[model samples]
Target: MSIGDGYRAVVDLLRHLRFFVAVAETRHFGRAATDLGITQPPLSQGVQKLEGHLGVRLFDRDARGVRLTVAGGRLLGPARALVDAAEDLLDQAGRLGGPVRARVGLCGDLGGWTPVACRALAGGSGPGLVVPRVAGSDRLLAELREGALDVAVVRHPGVVDGLVGGDVVGLPTRLLGADGPLDVPLAEVDRPLVVPPRRHQPPAHDQLVDTLRRAGHDGRVLEAADPTQRAALVAAGAGVALETSPGAQASGGLPPLRVRVVLPAARERRPEVDHAGLAAALEQALRR
Candidate 1:
């Protein structure tokens, strides 16, 4: 018998599940320590403890490096699955009331946003924004999946293949007022770009990256952690950013800026996916 056998015999275990999984994935104790944001000796001790409890080897450890043993490779799949299930459970728990709140992503200003959309979600006919400020499409969608938001509004380049889309359109094409010609091979170097994180980047990020890459220039992307800071950076001409704000008419105290609200090009049009279906599905999940 091995430490692994004893470890798995219990109906449940705490803490070490993640640590064990990390060791199996990375193989090296030091590297796994770094990934877990801890130190090397502790990670090694924990893995040893797991092995001792299970009564079998989980890793082939040596000075050269670490690799998962047969037992570990077998356990890795199930362990990873467990982690995913736990995350999904947490996400479903965080949703709001019966109706569920939907999030919409706005690429441009809100002049084109219909009032009907806002009123339906606000749960009343009071004076308020429809989508409010979601920062960007990625943030809104993450909220949507996590049950924080039931619906989201996003611009479609028609490239997002799997998830359905609705009201697809490009945004106003505001030129950032370059010192040179509008179309002259533009490039932003060292300047900060206010954009979504790679993990949560929206269709807009992809399109913008493509555009910059085609022009032989890589744009710097600053994650949208702080909307105000991101906005300020863009305003100062430090970088270009995608934002959703109340239209100029509604933006009372905000600085006056002229931006081209470029709509999606014809090739970028996406088919309308039913918002009703998404709402229904979300509601059912919360009930359970």
Candidate 2:
């Protein structure tokens, strides 16, 4: 093949490699397609094309789902690296034509920590602009996967597949009730547990519910969409809600909820941003 033909072949291979990586990580063509913003047929075809080019079976399809073959497992890391490199090249090229900005997502429950975290990120010498988007943990995760945000402060105990980061900080919480001892046992609260919708942060919601159950509270749960609503419900004698304490020492008796700093797994080591330093700063600021 001519040099031009060879270049086209590599480009074509990279396209297929993206498909391979997505499917490999998600372990399901349907979910991968949705994540990739494509239909299932094209995704399947792209993976098939990649397999044909590599001369190996990458995945075993079964009734349950897809599983990586031995060969696939071996090549997955390298394939991810190549795809990430290509994306980085494009990203850097785009940066050359414009001012650098980092889109950061913060969880809704950060409360007083929100302003501090924003200042920490914006004050950095890294990006020329720091845009902050606030939402629930699940929504933030989706935006990260879709490349809508560069980094996110997400709630712990939630799904973070295909991302890389560490726990940044934890905020202790206290039970807020209209009229009761602050140190009352959860089982003795008598009112329902007021919390946000489970769909917003499924794992954290389940963890909270399970902990309450274990603490002997098997009563009804009142769903509220935001902190204000939860607080209002608590004040109305509807239920007791967990609210972040002013300081670590203020925790009534519940476990602290944690926040983690996560970026796309592919961009974890990108030199454009100092994610670790930002996380450390957040930990310090939030702790105060």
Candidate 3:
């Protein structure tokens, strides 16, 4: 094959690998497609192509769900590395041609503080564009480690292995019930606690549950995917939601949920972007 043909083949292989990794992570074709912003048929075909090229069945699909084969499990690490390396190379190329672009990820429950932080980052005297992605703490950390994100403001008590930073900001949370806001003890409320799924932020979820239990709330816990859903559940009298607010006073309430900025430990790879300076800017933004 000519060099051009080889380059195209490598690109196709990378696409298939990306599809495989997405399906493996989500364990569902439809969900993976949604995450990848593609249709299910194309995603399935890509994964199938990858399996065929590798001469192994990567995923076993049944009526219930998808499960990875042993070969797939073994190849997942290297596939992720390849995908990350490709992305890093593209990012570096972009930086070489233009101003540096910093990608920042923020936790979903930041409420009004999200916009404030975005404005601060965008308006900074920094040299390039500031792009913000919003997601759960777990997703942010994973992206940070994979080199997809330059920095992230994740919830405290997160799994920050291979990353660095510390608590920088705290936002007070209020318990919202069907009638309205409630300032009473959690135990006094005779309803379940509505929160995001534990998988999204394990440490924060476990800590919140433990704290609630100690406060005498031995009730059911409803897991919602986002804050809007949680608030809707509360409004429908399903449960009470702990809603964070930037305007909330911290004088006499439950301890505010803390946020911290973190960057990958391997800073030498992309010396063009000042990760520490960006982190400091984010910390100041969240504080304001």
Per-model TM against the reference: 0.38, 0.64, 0.69
By lDDT, who's the top model here? 3
- Candidate with more favorable, higher lDDT: 1 or 2: 2
Best by TM-score: 3
lDDT per residue, candidate 1, 1-288, as tens digits? 433656554323334566788778777676676555455776778778767866778888677888888998887888788766765766576343233333444322332343333544454333222344444444444343333443555434423332344433333333332242122233434354465455444444566666656545565566655556656666767675443322312212212222111122233222232345444332232222
Question: Whose lDDT is higher: candidate 2's or candidate 3's?
Answer: 3
**Per-residue lDDT for 1-288 in model 2, tens only?**
222668788887888889889999999998998777455897899888788888999999989999999999999999999999999998879679676567788888776678777876667543336778988888888777767777888887777777776765668777778874267777787778888788878888888888888887884789877777877888899888777745534545575767788877664435676566655665666667
lDDT of 3 by residue, 133-229 (tens): 9998878887776568888898888767667866657777788789977878777878898887888788888888888887788846899877788
lDDT of 3 at 17: 87
**Candidate 1 TM-score versus the reference:** 0.38
